[model samples]
Target: MAASLTAFAAAASADTLFGAMEKAYVTNPTLNAARAGQRATDELVPQALSGWRPTVGVGGEVEALISTQRAVVPEADELVDAVINDEAVSGNLAIELTQPLFNGFRTVEGTKAAEARVDAGRQSLLETEQQVLFNVVQAYMDVYAFRQIVVLRKQDVAALEEQVRASNERFAVGEITRTDVAQSEARLAESKSALVDSQTNLARAVAKYIQTVGNEPGKLVYPKVVNLPKSMQMALDAAGEINPRLLAQAFVEVAANSDIGVARSGLLPSAGLLAGGQVSDPDFTEDQNENASAVFGASFSIPLYEAGLVYSQVREAKQRASQSRIQVIEIARDVRRAVVESWNAYVGLGEIIKNTRTQVSAAQLALTGVQQEYAAGTRTTLDVLDAQRELVFSQVLQVTAEKNRVVAGYQLLAAIGHLTAPRVGLKVPEYNPEENYQRVRNKWIGTSVETVE
Candidate 1:
C-alpha cells in the first residue's frame, strides 16, 4: 500500500495546470457569453454616429378631380344658361434629402457616451474572464486534493485490514484476547467508512471540475504557485489601480456624465440642410401641361418649451451620473477589502500547510511505534487502533491544507486583477475585446463586421 501511494505521488508531478486553464479559456460558456455581450456593445458607437449622416427619401402623389360649371350668355333682351362638366388628373413625384449640420452637440456627446460604454463593456468582460479562471483554479485544486485523499484512505483501509487479520490470528493462538481482535475489527470498519466518504468527496470534485473546465478531469498534476506582489500594500495598490470591476465602474461613471451632457444639449438649437425637387403633370397630359420646381434651404429649430420634459430628463441624468460616481467609490472600498482578506488567507494558509505536513510526519512515526509496542506486549490493541486513526486524520488534514494553500494563492491573484489568460500564459488564443471595438467603431454601413460566437 505504501509503495503504491509513493507511485501515485510521483505520477502527480506532471504539469497539467496549463492544459486545464487553456481548456477553460477557450471553451468556457460564461466567458464566451461575455465576449458576445461585448461585441454587441461595440455597435453603440456606430449607432450614435448615424445621427450625423444624410437621410434620403422618395415620395409620390396622385389625384383625380371632377367639376361641373354653369355659364349664362347675355343676348339682346334675352338670357341663356349653359352647364359644363370637366375632369382633370394630376400626378407628382418628389425626391428629398436632409443632412444634419448641427444638433446642438447632442450627437458629439452621444458618441462620447457610447465610446465610454464600450470601454466599460471591455472591462466588464475582463472581470468575467478573471472570475472564470479563478473558478478553474479552484476546481482543479479540489479534484487533485480529493483524489489524493482517496488514495490515502484506501491505503489506510488496507493497513487496518491487515492488522485485523493479524489480531484474529493471535487470538486463535491464545497470544491475544478476544477484545484485541474486536478492537482491530472496529478500526477496520471505521477506516472502510472513511474510505467511502473520501470516494464521495472525490466524485463531487470531479463534477465541479467538469462544470468549470468544460470537460471531465483527466490525470491531474499539481499546480505551482504563481509569483505575487512583494508586499500586501503593493497588492492593495495594484488592485485599486487596475482591478477590472473598479475600472468598469469608472468607465460607467464617465458614460453617465456624458449622458448628462447629451441631455443638456436638448436646450440648444439644431441646424440642418434640406434639398428637394418635384415634377408635376396636370390634366393628364404628359408634355403639354407640366410643371417642375426645385428647392434648397438651410433649416434651424429651437425648442421654445416642452412642458418641462427636457428639463426633467436633464435633472434625472444628473442624479444618475452622481449615483454612478458614488458607486465607483463604493467599489474601490470593496476591492481594497478583498485584497486585504485574500492576502491574509494566503499567508495563513502557508503557515497551516507547513504545520499540517509536520503533523502528518509525526503521526506516521507515532503509529509505527505504537504498532511495534503492541507486538512487544507493551501497548494494548486499542492504543494501536487509536494511533492509526490519528494518522488517517492527519493525512486528511494535510491534503486539505494543501488544497486551501493553492486556492488562497489563486484568490489573491484574482483580487490583484492579474488572473487573465495572457497574464497567466495560458497556451490558447486570447480573445481581444479591443479588436472587435476597433473593427466596428467607425463603420458606416453593414449589418455587423463579424459575429462573435
Candidate 2:
C-alpha cells in the first residue's frame, strides 16, 4: 500500500510530521513484526492455563493370534491331535482423560511467569514503536534540513553570478581592475561547485527519506514535538516511570523470579484424576462377542530421584533471575544517560540557533553595506566578495542550527519514551497491541489469521 502511495507532495506526503508518523505506525515493517511477536507471546498464557484443564484422547488397536498343538495318549495306545490349529482376532477401542488436580502449585506459578513475560513483551513492542517513530522523525528532518541548505547554495550561486557580471561591467568602464574581475569570477566558480555538492547532499537525503517513510517525500512541513518535559528533573522522572526499555527489563526480572517457583515445584508432589472407557471384541474383522469396561481413578506422584535434574533446573532459574535483576538496573542507567544527553542537546541547540540567527543578521547587513561602498568606489572588489562569503556562511550555519534544534527536541522526547502515535496525536488509529492480546489470551481450539508477513 505504501508502494502505491508514491504521490510525493506535502498534500500527497501527508504534509506534516504527524502524518508521516501515522503512516509509519500502520505500514512500518519493524513495528508490525514487533506486534506479531507480542501476539505470539500472548499465546503463552493460554498454554500455561491449559495445565489446569483436562486432556482427552480416543484410540483403538487390533490384534490376531494363531496357534497349533498336538497330543498323544499313551494309555489308549494311540496318538491323537488335541488342539491342531486355533486362531483368534481381537480389537480394542478406548477413550482416556486426565485432569490435573494439583501439581505443587506449578501451574499457578507457571501462569504467573507467562503473564509477566507477556507484559514484558508488550513493553518491548512499545519500545520498538518509539524507535521506529524516532527514526522517521530523524529521516524527515534530514531531508528538510538538506533541502534548505540546497536552497541557500542555489541563492549563493546566483548572488555570485550577479557580482561577477557587475565586476566585468565595471572593468569594461575602466572603474575596476582586471584582477578584481578575475577574483569575482573565481568566487562565482566556487559557489557553483558548492551548489553542486549541496544538490548531491539533497539527493542522498531524498533517498534516505524514501527508505524510512516508505514513500518519496514532497513538500514536507516541520511539525513541532509537543509535550516535552519542562526540566531535566521532569524528564528523568518520565524516563524512570515510562521508558519502555527499562520497564521491559523490570518485567523480565519479575518473570524470571516467578519461573524459580515453577522450577522448585518440580520437587513437590503432583496429583490428577484419570478416567477411561473401552470396548473389546474377540474378532477384529467380524464381531462375534463384545465386552465393555469403564474405570476412574486418582493418580499421584512425588519426585524421589531425578539424577539431580530438578535441583539443577532450580539453580539455573535462580541464576537467571539474578541476571535479570541486574539487567533492570543496567538498562535504567542507560535510559537515564540517554535522557541527559538528549535533554542537553535539545537545550543547547536552542541557544546555538539564537546566536546563529544574530550572526546571519549582522553578516547580511555587512554584505549590503560593502556592496553599497563598492558601488560608490570606496570598497575594493575583494571587500565585497569577502562580505558575501561571510553572509552565506552565516546563513548556512543558521540553517544548520535550526535543523539541529528541531531534531534535538524530537530526540529528547524519544529518549524519555514519549515519541509515540498517541502522544503526537497523529490523526490515525493508534495500534493497540493489547486488542490482539486480549482476543487470543483465552482462545482455545481455533486457528485464525489476521495478517500475513
Candidate 3:
C-alpha cells in the first residue's frame, strides 16, 4: 500500500488531480484518523458478543507467618512454657468459568447496538473521504486558475511595453507630445505592478495546492472538459440514495434505537452457567495435597427495582433517536438548497464565459485598429493605451469565469455528497475493519480459553 501511495503521489506531482486524491485517500492523516475511528468502533462487537461466550480465569496466593506462644501452670507448681513457631506457608490455585445462559435479551440487544455503531462509523469514514476529495478539487482548480492569470498578466505587460516603445519613437520623430509618451510609460509601470501581484497570488495558490494534495504540484493539468447536468433537479436525482450526511444520521438513529433495547433489557431476568476447580497446600502437614472439582450449573438473576433508572435511560435514548431522525430531515433540506444554489451559480458563470470570450475577441480587434491608426497619425496615444487596457480586462474576466465554472462544478458535487473517491474518478483504498474483530471473535466464540491472551 505504501508503494502504491508513493507512486500515486509521484503522479500527482505531475498535476494529476485524480491520482493526487487517491494518494490522499491512502495516506492523508485526516482520512487515516477516520479509518482508525472506524476500527475502534469494531471492538464493540466483541464486547457485545462476550455475553454469549464462556469466561475463564485462574488465580493463586501464598502466605507465611511466625508467632510465639507461652503456657503457665497452676500457682502451686508454677511453671512457664514458651515455644517459637516459624516456617508457615499456605497456598491455593483455583480456576473459574462462567457462561451466560440468559440476560433478559441484553446480549442480543447489545450485539444489535454494536452492529448499528459499526454502520455509523462506516458512514463517518465515507463523509471524511468526501470532504477530503472536495478539498483536493478546490485546491487543484485554484492552482490552474492562478496559473492562467499569470500567463494573461505577462501578456498584458508585454503589450504595455510595446506601446511604450512605440510612443517613444513617435516623440523622437516629433509625431507625438511628451505627455503622450509619459502616459504610455505610466501604463507600462501599472502593468508591471499588476504582473507582480498575479505572480504573488500564483505562489500562494501553489502552496495551498501542496498542502491540500500532500505533494508539490509540478505541472498542473487542467481538465480538458467538464460537463454539467442540465438542471439542479437532475443533479439531485443523480445523487440517488447515498448522501453521506443522511446515511450517517440514519445509522445514528439506528444506534440510538438500539440503546433503548439495551436499557429495556436491564429490567428483565438474567441467567448464566458456572463451573470451577481448586487445589490447596497447608504448612501444618509436610505434604502437598491436590483437589479438583468441576460442576456445571445454571444461575438466574431477576431484577426487582432500580429506582426507575432503566426507564429513564430508555426515555433518553428514545429522545435522542427522535433527534437523529430530525437531523436527517434537516440535512436533506440543506442539501437540496445547496444543490440549487450551486447549479444556478454554475449556469451563470457559463454565460459569463461565453460573453467574456466575445469581449476578448472584440478587444483584440479594437487594439489592432487603434495601433494602426496611431501610426497613421489618425488616433491619439491615449486611444491605443485605452484599447490595450480594455483587452487586458476582458482577458482577466475570461480567466476568472473559467475558474468559477470549475469551482462551481466541484461545489455541486460536494453538496450532493458525491465528491468521494469513486464518484470523482479516484480509487478508494479498501480497509476492512472486521478483519481484526473476526480474529478475536472467532476464537472466543463457543469455546473456553485458559487465558485471554
Top of the candidates by lDDT: 1
For 318-429, candidate 1 gives per-residue lDDT tens digits of: 9999999999999999999999998999899888888888998999999999988988999988998899888889888988988888888878888889898888787788
* Model 2 per-residue lDDT tens digits across residues 1-453: 675566443355455777777788888888988888888888989899989989999999888899878776454777665656778888889999999999988989989999999999988988898888888887888888888888988898889889999988999999989999999999999999888988898888788767767888868776676999899999999989998889889989999999999999999999999999999897766765888999999999998988999999999999999999999989999989999998999889889988998999999999989999988999999999999999889888988877777788888887788887888677887777778778877777789956525
Per residue, candidate 3 scores C-alpha lDDT tens digits across 1-453 of 999999778766676667767877777777877777776677688888887988899998887876766656455577666464657777788889998888888888888888888887887888888788777777887788878888988988898888888888879999989999999999999999999998998888878777777888777776632345677777887654676777777888887788888888889899888988887776635674545556667899898999999989889889988998898888788877888888888889989999999999999999999889887889999998899999989998998888888778877877777777655666665655556556555454453322211
Off by over 4 Å in 2: 1-14, 63-89, 164-189, 374-382
Task: Give the Å shift of residue 282 in candidate 2.
Answer: 3.7
Candidates sorted by lDDT, best first: 1, 2, 3
Could you tell me which 10 consecutive residues in candidate 3 have the lowest summed lDDT?
Answer: 444-453
lDDT of 2 at 209: 68
Error of 2 at 119 (Å): 1.0
Q: What are the Cα lDDT values of the candidates?
A: 0.89, 0.87, 0.79
Top candidate, metric TM-score: 1
Give the C-alpha miss distance for residue 77 in model 3, angstroms: 12
* TM-score per candidate, chains pooled: 0.86, 0.86, 0.83
Pitting candidate 1 against candidate 3, the one with the higher lDDT is 1
Model 1 alpha-carbon drift over 4 Å, by segment? 1-15, 61-91, 170-187, 280-290
